[model samples]
Target: MNLLIAFLLTVLLMSGVWLWQRRSGRADWVDAFWAGSIGALAVFYAVFGDGAVEKRVLVALVAGTWSFRLTRHLAVRLAGHEQEDGRYQAMREHWGERAQFWLFVFFMGQALIAWLFSLPAWVVANDPSPAMNVWVILGVVVWFVSLAGESLADRQLSAFRRDPANRGKVCQVGLWRYSRHPNYFFEWLHWFSYPLIAMGAPFQWLAWLGPVLMLLFLYRVTGIPYTEKQSLKSRGDAYREYQRTTSAFIPWPPKD
Candidate 1:
């Protein structure tokens, strides 16, 4: 029943956002709503679902913090945008006359992903364990590190972009110097927190899916591929050099 409610609520939220997207002709709002919806689900599960007070509160805070931060960041970045994201724009060109239908499908896809990603939070929130295990402690530490690292990456990129002189150049400062996509690495790393937080909880195996699937998406589907393509288009040899020297997803010392 709770699961059904979560799914229905997510669908309803996404449906409303889709209407807004249709009116504005910008699909980027899906990203903002994705983060917000996840946070909302965490709070809902924490407050209404079965769990020990401690675990429920912890899950809500941790997940809610991450979710709200991401949502606000995306919202600010996307404010007053009159066009869709480049990724979706490219899709629109490809789909042509069928673009509207396909875009609706895309919105639904994000809605589904939002629900799927909430699974770990759901598990962690319902752990019902009074004990503060070592795994939970480690999870909290990782969450803090990942959140800070992701924020640092965002700031570095934002600062680089703010400098008009750096136009058409790649960001290779701070965390960007080591990894081409430090933000993605930290985002993917964030997923591991749930399994650790729910270490002793039932269906801990399900929590593992967050990290695994997120890694796959970042590596293959939505993260590095499109961003690198855009960089290659704009920065050309500069980006290629960065790619040759920097790690793609992990934070490692640059090769050259």
Candidate 2:
């Protein structure tokens, strides 16, 4: 019943966004929606679920915090642009007249993916434990570290971008110096919190799905490949050099 409701709501939300994209032709809103939907589902689960008060509150706090940060960052990047994200723009070009139909499908898929990723949050929020425990504290700690690390990486990259003199140069400052995608690494690490948070809950093992799927997505699907392709195109030899010296996902000192 709850699953049905969440899916229906997600589909509805995506449908509305698709209509808006049709009218405005800006598909960048999808990223914000994806982030916002995950937050919404976490809050929904926290409020309506029969979980222990401690578990519910903690899950909501962690999920909601991540959602807020990610969506806000995407919103700012999306602001003042009628242009769709480059990936979506490429899809538009490829699909031609069929773009709208395929994009509708894409948007709907995003909603499902968002919900799927929230399974750990759902389990945590539905836990019946009466008091906070070590697992809960550990989850919170991991969430904090992941969020802080990702946030710092974003800020450093943003600051680098804001400097006109840095244009065409690859970012090697701060976290970027250590990993080619510190932001992605931290984002992947965020999933580990849920397994810890959902400890002892029914289907707690399901929590592993989030991190595994995210790593696959980041490594092969929607993440590093496309990003590196674009970076290579833009920064040319600089990004290649950075790629050579920096760890691809994990943070470590740059290779000499």
Candidate 3:
């Protein structure tokens, strides 16, 4: 089946990525490849799925845009092949002598996750419905908001970090003023759009995996915990104060 082939291709490509990381000694590319692999699989499913051409094309465009934006954003950080991200550096330190082995496993896990996240796109592409419905429109709207908010958050953080005056300061500009991790929040919000888009499709329930899995990882596993730890380590009391005043995952007024 097309799904099986996509999954296999993802694993194959990520294996190559792992090898490249091993050679380059940079784990940052893992995130870029993860985003890119999902986009590739989404487009593949859209192009080859047995469904309405319009629906497939729409999903392809949407998913591709999401992937491109995220991947490019991540890629920018890798300019000059800068030092590895703190989180990954910490991971390498923790794993020590077995770092390469664990990183290989981590890269493969990302490949699997990329495929899993593509489920909504695959379902949407396979939907035979030719008409655009309220749900699809809603999904697009949510996608717009998520993309805009996330971009704003990233830009704000980048601008803050770029300023010599802001060094060692917690970013409290733009969206960051309200949410400690606005980018992560909006990234998580982006997953909801796929489920909305998948409404009424066969296997629509599978679409829920996007938002559900994203929330689980962002909240409990990969997103908040590491970022918070890194921030606390680097920013110390400033980050602690930000944490005290700002919502951890949602945009809201800061506490007094």
| TM-score on alpha carbons, each prediction | 0.97, 0.98, 0.97
Clashing pairs in 3: none
Residues 101-127 of candidate 2: C-alpha lDDT, one tens digit per residue: 999889989989988988888888888
Q: Which stretches of candidate 2 lie over 4 Å from their true place?
A: 80-82
Most accurate candidate by lDDT: 2
lDDT of 1 by residue, 50-82 (tens): 878888899898899999889988988988566
RMSD (Cα, Å) of model 1:
1.1
List candidate 3 segments past 4 Å from native: none
- lDDT scores in order: 0.89, 0.90, 0.90
Cα RMSD (angstroms) for every candidate in the order listed = 1.1, 1.0, 1.2
* Candidate numbers, best lDDT first, in rank order: 2, 3, 1
Residue-pair clash count for candidate 2: 0
Task: Flag the better candidate by lDDT, 2 or 3.
Answer: 2
Off by over 4 Å in 1: none
